[model samples]
Target: MNGIDIHNYVDCNDMFRAAANFFAACCRCAVAEKGVFNVAISGGSTPDGLFEELVKMKDSLPLEAIQWFWVDERCVKPDAPESNYGRAAKKLLNRLQLQLDNVHRIEAEKPEAAEKYEKIIRTLLPLNKKGLPVFDLVLLGMGPDGHTASLFPEKFNDLPGDKIVLKVPEPEHILPAVPRITLSMQAINSALEKVFLVTGNNKMELLKVIKNGQGNHYPAAGIFQAAWFVCCKPGSQD
Candidate 1:
């Protein structure tokens, strides 16, 4: 990756540990400096291990100073199995005793979920010079087809530049296919730090395309100054 920093690990466990440690470090630093650590996290099975690892470190983390937000959400109730907030809540938040108010989940089932989420982000996060909310950290995951935070390849060109959150009503081909609400590319790029957690041997070839910078059509490739925490070693097979 021309503009990305690559951190390779031998396996999924190692990769999750490294990413969790990185997240903890960022949380401590941000909370120490500004009294708050605001972060937006992506959904998917890939990050579940990282969430579990973080839960194990609950005693050391400044849970009170951390504010949680989601990068995107499916159009389902919070209790649904596929819901990102639901997964994190079960694996991490509930374990850490994080207050409900600090968890800013996107209510994707509502008609104005995107607008409501944008308002909440603006209210809680500090804005940069360009007036974009700056999150202390943004944890992301890249789909096998190169999508990130619900930004798919088919509608890459049609994404709104001025919006903080976008309502994705047409996600017909993707798994768990349904409506979604996601942060715009502008919102993601404005974050102070962004990291992508990529594991599994099946993703090596797609990672190659991203690393070579030939995936302009892919949403994950367009992220600004991203660090890739990858465990899929070259030549590894399932």
Candidate 2:
């Protein structure tokens, strides 16, 4: 891989454990260095397992000292099944003892959600010299078509690289085809850590493209210094 560090796992469970361990370590390090760990997480089937694994390590991780944010959110009410915040809240937030103020969910149903989220980030997280909020970690998941966050391949050329938050139009190719609000590439790349949780043999071909650095058309390939945690059948890398 040109810029990605690949970690292979025999199955999704093992990959989730490795991801959870990495998350816990990052939380501890960030909390120890500062007072809180600011992390932004994505929503997907892959991360659902990681969220469960994280619950098992609640005692080991600095749950109370960690500030959670969303990488992207579908334009739905918080209780909607398609709501990313709803999924995270059920799978992780409700399981941990975190500060209510630290859970920064994207209220995507509101028209001003993107602007509000951008303001919130500037108000809470530390800003870099470029004026972008620097997060301790930004956890992401790659769709089979190579989309990360709500940045789909069809809309790659349209995304503003300098924006903090972007209002994404409804994707025609992907499911839950609703409009979304997402952190822009500039915001995501400003994070201290960037990770992708990718599993299943269906993603092998795209992973190959991304690993060989030939996936410039794919939104996930635009991520800087991304580490991919992949799980698939043994020898699938060949």
Candidate 3:
């Protein structure tokens, strides 16, 4: 519940540029030190902007050294419009020259999908002496409801386990057709860097409440080590 580094931008385009720059820097740093970069990405309108920006910078960005993963994904076929991976594939991954092996997608259609995805993540991650997967960067998004990575305020009680991948039950009226698979808070915080891209006027009040440390009930409150960029209209509060 610590205050995150807040960066406010006048518009979504500016936020996208800044996010792309941050990703490029992290990719370079990881490649220089470890020869590989693992990044977990969230799905939302804000990330779509950043993904388009990254696509534009594909030539300059270190595309080859980075391994892409989703922080959460809707349970759907890869070709579905509702699929987070499908959106990213259309916007960024498909445009890049990076190898298919570098994109580790959540198996949304598999039976026991969350457990299977967890196994895949465990295999790709570099184990420490105690056998924990360490990530280079994790990019997140905030819903107006203050949820992040499929973790909602009402669902906080369900988050205490040590599992890397979690199966989230579908919300009553959510858009996605099935359940969700998301990385747990433990896995998310293990990343070297975490970034959040949030936008729009509807979220300002909740953002303020979160920054004031009044709403620990929200899953977004679990993100203590991340740097957040809030893209708002001109003269919006931070």
Candidate 4:
């Protein structure tokens, strides 16, 4: 939460269009500079609009050179109605002409789900001098409770020290699931850039509170190091 950048839209439709353009431009720039674009995505109602917008611009963007990964995922079957990957698959991935191998999914069904996803990330991402993977861009969404990824305020005890992926139990009334695999704070901050897609009137007051440095109870406030924070909401004046 490095002071959120608010880009107000007249409605959800307008917000989605702007978000799609931002993502497309970012992907194009990354591909031009690095030959490929690696992006970690978040799941939420807000992001669903963005994903739908992205689907319409498949030809205009660098879909072929983009490698996709999830920032976090619910512990459920791939085709489960509640599965984020499943939603993304039907909304975007399944409609694209991109290679199936380019889409890396978190194996939530694996015995050691978090560890398996971490291995997958390590195999695909470039390592730094400290042997940590550095991502190009990470897309995040803020929950109504201000939790981002799987780092709920009440679930701090479940935070991982491995500097990779971890399984966090959902706090009651927060997420509607058991354990979820998510990237650690260290991993998310390691990305060269980050983008937050937050929308709706319900989020307006909380966004203001977070910017004023009053709400530290939420884990999303820990993202002070993120390079960029983008907001999409109606009449939202930063």
- lDDT string for model 1 (1-238, tens) is 5488889888789889999999999999999899999999988888888998998898999999999999999999999998988988888788888888899999997898998999999999999888889999999998877899999988878878888899876565787988889998889999989999988788778888888989888899999798899887667775
The better-scoring model by lDDT among 2 and 3 is 2
lDDT (Cα, tens digit) per residue for candidate 2, span 5-51: 98998888999999989998888899999989999999876798899
Q: lDDT score, residue 210, model 4?
A: 82
Worst 10 residues of 1 by lDDT: 168-177
Candidate 2 accuracy as lDDT: 0.90
Find the candidate with the highest lDDT and give its number. Answer: 2
What lDDT score is found at residue 148 in candidate 3?
A: 89
What candidate 1 gets wrong by more than 4 Å, as runs, is 233-238
TM-score of each: 0.96, 0.96, 0.93, 0.90
Q: Write the per-residue lDDT of candidate 3 for residues 58-152, one digit (tens) a residue.
A: 88766778899999988888888888888888777887856989999898777688888888888988865545567899999888778889887
lDDT values of the candidates?
0.89, 0.90, 0.83, 0.78
Residue pairs in clash, model 2 = none
Instruction: Between candidates 1 and 2, name the one with more favorable lDDT.
Output: 2
Ranking by lDDT: 2, 1, 3, 4
Q: 225, model 4: CA deviation in Å?
A: 4.8
- Off-target runs (Cα >4 Å) in candidate 4 are 1-3, 225-238
